[model samples]
Target: AQSVTQPDARVTVSEGASLQLRCKYSYSATPYLFWYVQYPRQGLQLLLKYYSGDPVVQGVNGFEAEFSKSNSSFHLRKASVHWSDSAVYFCAVSAGNTGNYKYVFGAGTRLKVIA
Candidate 1:
């Protein structure tokens, strides 16, 4: 069994500041790590994925994450965040099952950017 967790339920940040979101996972085998962002009611967009080699994975919209095997964590970071970046971020994990596999999503961290 594989699972993902995001500790923070909400984060408030000033616009143009550095930001980071936490993630942790529990999996017996190597799992596919992913970060997704949801603007409102739309489907989640893949920010990045960590499957095999690289520990540090680069993502879209000026975001990146580091995969730590020992800690079982994959945390997302952004050097500078915009007002538009204020949204719900979800961490997900999937076992390598291609046939009708499902991704477990975090509760979500609502990022509120203040001006």
Candidate 2:
């Protein structure tokens, strides 16, 4: 079975501080990993995805992630965060050939940025 675990349920950081969101996954075959950010009342938007190529993938909004097969983890990072970044961040994964492409979202880590 494939699954994802986010160590933190909520994270609070001051504006302009660096942020790191941890994510761990379990899967048989090589998995397709994704990071998505959802603002309040809005749908999810893809932050980054790693399939085969580069171990590090970059996404919009100044977010990036690194894929590690050995550790089975893909953690998201940002150099600096803004109040606007205060939303739910989700780590998603799909095994092998990407099912439904619909994504299995993590329980989501709520980020609260203080100014």
Sequence-dependent TM-score of model 2 = 0.93
Query: Tens-digit lDDT track for model 2 on 1-115?
Result: 6889989999999999999999999887789999988998899988889989899889998999999999999999999999999999999998767454545668989999999
Evaluated at residue 33, the lDDT of candidate 1 is 92
lDDT of 1 by residue, 82-110 (tens): 99998999999998765438888888899
Off by over 4 Å in 1: 97-100
Residue 62 error for model 1, in Å? 0.7
Each candidate structure's TM-score, on Cα atoms with residue i matched to residue i, is 0.93, 0.93
Runs off by more than 4 Å, candidate 2 = 98-102
> Which pairs clash inside model 2?
none
Q: What is the C-alpha lDDT of each candidate?
A: 0.91, 0.90
> What lDDT does candidate 1 reach at residue 21?
98
